[model samples]
Target: SIEGYGIHGNSAEWSIGTSASLGCFRLHNKDIQKLFSLVPVGTPVQIVYQTVRGGIDLNNNTAWLEVYPDIYQWSNPELESAKVIQSLGWIYEPHWQALGNLLQAKKPLRVEIPRVIKIEGESLDIDGFYWQQQVYLSQKCLEVLTVNFKTLRADELFSGFVKLDTTDLPGGNSQYFWDPQANTLRIIRLKVLLNGMELSDAASWSSDHRLLMNIKTIAAQLNAKFDWDCVSKAAICNEMKLVGEPRDGVFWVELEGLQRVWPQLKSTWDGKNYTLELMYKKR
Candidate 1:
């Protein structure tokens, strides 16, 4: 029942997707000129007479704001006076050194976002790149895997969740080494101290619990990229260490009774870059 399906007079529904136009199918004019060359002419072309007025709202409920990409506002200026420390989506070099310390402290940066959404205060400038439909007022800066809570130490806590301390990798070892606070591939080789020999042998506790379950599955896949839960509680986490990097390496661990942890790899340099830290510790 496309309003009494076609051939009524000439045409009654010209609905073309700012919302609902892909319903009754029947577009041609080179597919309506490639869907009007993919939108952008006062952009908010929402039009719906029914089907619940396609979620009704003719800008009467407020939500159509528009500030588009004009970067020529000299941009960010220093987004709300810089210092937001973490929004890490993209824009490297810590938002260009926080807009170079807010332009050497002459401050007055801007970075606001809301979306092409507003009604109680109508505003529009159309033609946003030939109507691909504007809705973009992005001004992001100060980025590069940041972490410096005003130079932390008020009992340190948020260097983006401090996980890279790697105490110089278990002290350049001859043994006891398994490190990855970030990266340096010092994988596995359980010894338990060999000046006298007695790491509770069983072939070094089954090759150190299979390399502590491969370093607890590389610290639960790098703390599951933040959803955190870097597992590895037992079977042999009694610490086997190299910490990661010190001219070729190896470290392993094991306890047993039915707990498992294994994953090992190391090679950290930190003198400038070369990183690969991975760690997991628990009783």
Candidate 2:
């Protein structure tokens, strides 16, 4: 009699919430129809007499353990607490390990919770550099420093941003402009200067308004030979290697990485202005 627990329809709809089912569980026709279409035939259905269940939220943000009265008087109360603790291990173990590591280190624990980005009430992935604040680069903004402002081409495979050539532009303002080729978005002010001259169209502001530039552009402007190994995804400037990779059709290198490659490189940022300085013997 206890073996027949498969879902079935019953005439007694009033006893839906209580333990009125003799052995077979009853569901509304619509609910059973929905489940019938979704679940495969070999799915296992556990009918535990215990009144406690534990679960962690799908996002892993919250965990829960709840207990109710053993309405059927079928479960042993002596082992129920242990069962609940064991069930909650799936959620508690990872958290406990992290806490234990911090405690053993004998240092204060600091957690960096990532901030969510939203635009016009729609959520977006937070994938850009975040320092004092978050910095995101738009394709239009990056194009400003590459397109007509500098001699660069957009890689057809990636095609989201542009690349630069070592060609020089004389008498042009050391600033960058974003042109869609068919239209122009806006122009960005240059924060870096080279040889007492403002670096024309090499550096621009990211979406967070933080200054960003390509290391190759700076190297070329400084007359350093910049070569990219597409196969290895590396940047070599004047035989000095700097780690770099292509992103959305644009190759970029970190400012600190450039400093590591060229020790003579010096930079000063006075809140309002950013200036890069270097001294080399002209040959």
Candidate 3:
């Protein structure tokens, strides 16, 4: 008995506008009318199976179809729960890059450098990979400066960039800095005369000395330029040179000649402005 109703008639549900068969026999209304009476109460009915293009012979007895929802397996390794890098932020920082070995899920590894360093009087852990040298000596914390992951022993000099296999990076640039070094770092600025004393105070010299004693200095090292005696005019003619030399500290004038030193004084004074030329030779 056809107990359930399905898509009927010549509507769009009708495949090819004909029998809506899953290969089952279909009856038009007139045919169904006559067949209803002719069919016996106990007559047996059989249904055969089929794939999209292949048919099964139920009378002949065949195996089943292997229809699956899809054909391929979609897998993403990078997103896999196990493959992602754990504690990534900790390792990538400038101060921590060398400490990656400490983060092992297993036992800690011992890292020894030819010359070790520290900030203040604190000592580095006995076991660890060598982090980079802290250039700023006065820093109190251990800056993750380097990780001699491959252990290059021959050279240790750096400039505007650090060579990493195939790529280059700015000398002292990194997102992850936690100034283990405590002191404030200063930079140089251009002035009229750049004597060695002022330049030494402003440049990296102080930090470098501090770095020599510490085993784990934390401040980063940076290099920059300082300018002095800038001028708009190209040529000059002057007289009355003034000379002054002191024993210590910077002994140089801001502007030499009275004319050059106080060029603006003429406009403000009652014509009492003076000009005197001078020369300096590192004295």
Candidate closer to the true structure by TM-score (higher is better), 1 or 3: 3
- Cα lDDT for residue 251, model 1? 29
| Winning model by TM-score | 2
Q: Among all windows of ten consecutive residues in candidate 2, which has the lowest summed lDDT?
A: 126-135
Tens digits of lDDT, candidate 3, 73-143: 34332222112223222222122332222222222222211112222212322212113333322111123
Give residue 7's lDDT in candidate 1 (0 to 100). Answer: 16
Candidate 1, residues 102-158, lDDT tens digits: the string is 244222223222112221111222110000112111111012111222221221211
Give the deviation of candidate 2 from the true structure as CA RMSD: 19.5
* TM-score for each predicted model, relative to the true structure: 0.15, 0.30, 0.16
- Give the per-residue lDDT of model 2 (tens digit) for 1-283: 3354678666777777576876677888778888889987658887666555556554534444445556667775325534654666543222222222222222222322111222221122212211112222234534333333434444332234333332232112133233322122222234556566665545544433344557767877767788877678787887877656554444566567766767777766644334454443344
lDDT to native, each model: 0.25, 0.47, 0.25
In candidate 1, what residue range of length 10 has the lowest lDDT sum? Answer: 127-136
| TM-score of candidate 2 on Cα atoms, chains taken together | 0.30
Kindly report which residue stretches of model 1 are placed more than 4 angstroms away from their true locations once superposed. 1-145, 151-217, 222-263, 277-283
